[model samples]
Every structure is written in structure tokens, then in C-alpha cells.
Target: MARKTKEEAQLTRQQIIDAARAVFHESGVSRSSLDAVARVAGVTRGAVYWHFKDKTELFHAVREEVSSPLLARSHAILDSGDYADPLDAVEAAIVDFFRILEDCPTLRQVLEILILRCEYVDDFVDVKAEVMQPAFEFNERVAAAYRRAAALGTLRPGLEPESAARDTLAFTTGLLHLLLGTRDANGIREQVPAMVSAHLALRRR
Candidate 1:
């Protein structure tokens, strides 16, 4: 009986999260309200309070839906010393980010919400700040990888590691911007691997 009740509680929590994403995505977080999320979830306003403290917290929870898995992979690659080829690990990680979009519809919706729907301002400032930490971590990780690659003679001679890291991140971000802004998934997937390959080709001897 207790187990069943716990499962129901978890189910309700997820329902609230999903509803929050849709509401914030459609209405934009600045304009959205917890009452709207509760209505969308078909739950009492108290249920939302039961699951989340407020709208900002709900927004973070929604962002974590995608960011958490990516963060874990980034941390693992950054922390692990066993990789025989750091370049391949980084390339695979980038490819996986694109590949998941094609395969996961819910993730695609959540990403669309993040990249297209929400604007960062006012109450969203703290949420934006939380996201910056991961970006800094990723910058350090990629910079370290480029430095190691340069040391091993894998990167083109005389290339600056920090510049290369920043450029790579910029290029990746641009690709994501184009993909999301245009909503061009069909040709995008076919070109993604080639794009990554060409980017790496320029760096290698």
C-alpha cells in the first residue's frame, strides 16, 4: 500500500514537471504562473506546491531534464584519465548531443522550449546563472583536451589551445543555433558528422 502511494506521488511529480515545461514554453517563463501549470497538469495548485517551491525552481527542474545527462557525460570525460584518445571522446560527445535530438521527441520538445521559447530576464536571471557554471566547466574541459592533444602532436602545430577550445565551442553553439532556429532535422543529421569531421580535420596534422 505504501509502495503504491509512493509510485503515485512520483507520477504526480513528473506530471507537474511536464506541465510546467509546456506552460513555460508556450507562455514564456516571465509571463507564466504556477496556477497555469497546475491547470495544465490537471492537479490542484497545492500539488504544484507539493512538488516545487515556486516557478523559478520549476524552471530549473525542467532545464535539468536535459542538462543533467549531458553534464554527467562531460564530467566523466573531463575526470577520466583512461581515455586513449580524448579527441574521439569529445567528438563522440558532440555527435551524441545531435543524435539524441532525432531520437527523443520529448527531449526535442524540451530543447525547443529552452532554446526558442524562454527568454532570460528578471526571475530567470538566477536560472541563467546556474547554466553558466556548466559552460565554464565545459570550457575548461575542452581547453584541457586541446592542450593535451597539442602536446601529443595531434593538433596542428602553433595552434593555441584556449583559442581552439573557444572556437570549437562557438562552432558547436552556432550549429545548434542553426539547427534549432531553422528546425531542419532531416538534412541536419546527415551533415552533422561531416561537419564534426571537417572541424577536426583542420586541427589534426
Candidate 2:
């Protein structure tokens, strides 16, 4: 057999992921079978196994693809640029996250898996932990941003930015689950920006 080129390997991996997304979207992750994903991708079962160890790993990969750009943009925004107010950076980050989910269905599926189906699974915590790393990092930045805002006297006296960031993100994650879980998955796109603005309004201006 001819050795597969790197491009070919990546194409196969993406094919599997795309197939899995279609299957999961149509029937949901809980009901979609690996065999069904394999058939959709027109690949062998062994190929799916070769690309991803199991459903969770595949889901994780999808989540990574969905969130990686947002993660990079967020880190860049927080780490660089002289902002008029540190809190503005926080608002920017929040707005970015809200907009990202509206644009990325794969990431939205990650939220759905956590809030909708994983509630009944024993390893739900594990799944949550695996997928929450990006949120945690963003919260860390929020905390640091909060401190900066506090130093500038722009933020309220008692609020803890770091802890608040963590809390706010956790709250928003749950909110996203509930909101998206009940409504048509794609419908949240039109509303997340306003929802984000409302949540940010809770902070002292």
C-alpha cells in the first residue's frame, strides 16, 4: 500500500469528525453510534478507532476545534494592547465568547453534551473537566483583569475579580446549557450578545 500523505491523513481525520458531527446532530451524541459515524464517513470502523480512541475523545477533539480560535483570540486580547480600562478587556472577552458559540455549532454541541446528556452519565464530571479548561483559563484572565480594574478605581470595592471570573463563567456555562438545551440549538445565535450584555451589566460600571 502507498504511504498516506500528511494531507491525506488530516483529510481522513476531518472526514471522520465531520461525519460524527452530522450523526450526532441528527440523532444526538447519546444515540449516535460509532458504527453509524463510520458508515457516514465511508471509512472502516478501524479507521475511526485509529483517529479517535472513543466517543469522548472524538467529542473533545471537536470541542478543541470549535474553541481553539476563540481561545487564541482571547489570550491575545488579554495579553496585549493597552486598553482604556481593564474592565473593557473583560467585556470584550465576554462578548467574544458569546459571539463564538453563536457562530460555532460544534462548540455548542460540547455545551449540549455537558448540560443535556451527561447529567445521566457517571463520568459527567470527567467530561466537564476535560472540556472546561478553556473557560478556566479565561476566568484566570478575568481575575487578573479585575485586579487591574480595581487598582484603577473603576470597579466596585468588594468584588473579587478572579473569583468572580470563575463564578461568572461557571454561571454562564450552566446558563448556556439551559438556554440552548431548551431552545432550538441554532436560535441562540441571535440572542447571546444581548444575554452577555445583561450578564456584564451586573458588574459595577
Candidate 3:
């Protein structure tokens, strides 16, 4: 075999990751094999192994590939500092998440693979931590927004930022689960504005 340049190696690695996404999306992770991914990517089994130690590592890589962009968008929204009503800013961020999911099919598929296709038995419990880091950051952003709302007297006087943050986080989690379960072709994209409105209405002064 001819030697591959570093650029060729990186391209091959990404091709394998793309193939893994398709394979994992089509067949659950436990059922999908690196050989199947290699075939899909038009690479040798040795090529797949060169880039990833095993299926588990490849799965994590696939997730990281999709997740980094999603988290970056979330971080950008949190860092934008554009909304006068911090609560409105927080709601806009959540709405933007749904818009992203609706707008990007590749991303939506990756999220679907993570949410509906994968199981977390045994060592796979660690797989969940990959999800928690952004969630924790998201929670902090919501908490900060709530604190800003409180300071501005937009929030009901007695409302606590911590409690609001926790409730909003839990609500967002439930919304995502239901959205996945329903799998409505265009689900939540339209509903988010009204939902956020009703949610914030409850806490408004």
C-alpha cells in the first residue's frame, strides 16, 4: 500500500466517522460493527482500526463530532449578551436549539441516534457523561439568566433563581424526550415560542 499523507489520513478518519454515523443511525450502536463502517466508508478494516481503538471509541468520536458544533452554538448564544430581558434571552436560546435540530438533518440524526437508538447498560453508563457536560453548562446559563431577571424585577419577587433554573432545565429535558418520542416531522420548532411564553408567564412580575 502507498503511504498516506497526514491530510489523507485525517480525511480517511473523517470519512470513517461519517460512515459510523450512518451505520449507527441505521442500526443501533451495539449491533453496528467497525467492519460495516469500513465498508460504508470504502476503507479497509485496518484503516478503521488505525483511527479508532474500537467501536466504543468510534461512537464517542461520532458524538463529539456532532456535539462540538451544537455546544459551540449554545455557548455563542449564552455569550452573546444581547437580550434585555435575560429570561427572553434564555428562552431564545432554547428556541434556537429546536431550530438547529430542525434545520440540520445530520445533527438531528446524531441526536436521534443518541436519544432513541442507544442503550446505556454496563460500561456504557460512562457514555452518559458525554451528555452531561453541556447540560451542566446550559443549566448554569439558565441560572445566570434567572438571576438577571430577578435583579431587573421582571421575575416574581419571591422566585429563586436556583429553583427556576432547575425547573427550566427539567422542563427542557422533558421537552426533548417527548420530542424524540413523538418524532413529529417538524416537532417543537413552532411550539417552542408558545411554550416558552407560557413558561415565563408563570414567573413574570
lDDT of each: 0.80, 0.74, 0.84
Tens-digit per-residue lDDT, 1-205, candidate 1: 9999999999999999999888877887778899999999999999999889988788888888888887787667655677665676667667777787778777777777777787787777667667666667777788888788887888788889899888888888788778878855678768998998888777776
Q: Against the hidden true structure, what lDDT does model 2 obtain?
A: 0.74
Q: By lDDT, who's the top model here? A: 3
User: How well does each candidate superpose onto the true structure, as a TM-score?
Assistant: 0.89, 0.80, 0.91
Over 4 Å off, model 1: 77-83
Candidate 3: lDDT of 203? Answer: 78
lDDT at 157, model 1 = 89
- What's the lDDT for residue 1 in model 2? 33
| Models sorted by TM-score, best on top | 3, 1, 2
Error of 3 at 54 (Å): 1.5
In the range 70-97, model 3's lDDT, one tens digit per residue, is 8788767766678778877777788888
TM-score of 3: 0.91
Record all residue pairs in model 3 with backbone atoms less than 3 Å apart, i.e. clashing.
Answer: none
- Arrange candidates, best lDDT first: 3, 1, 2
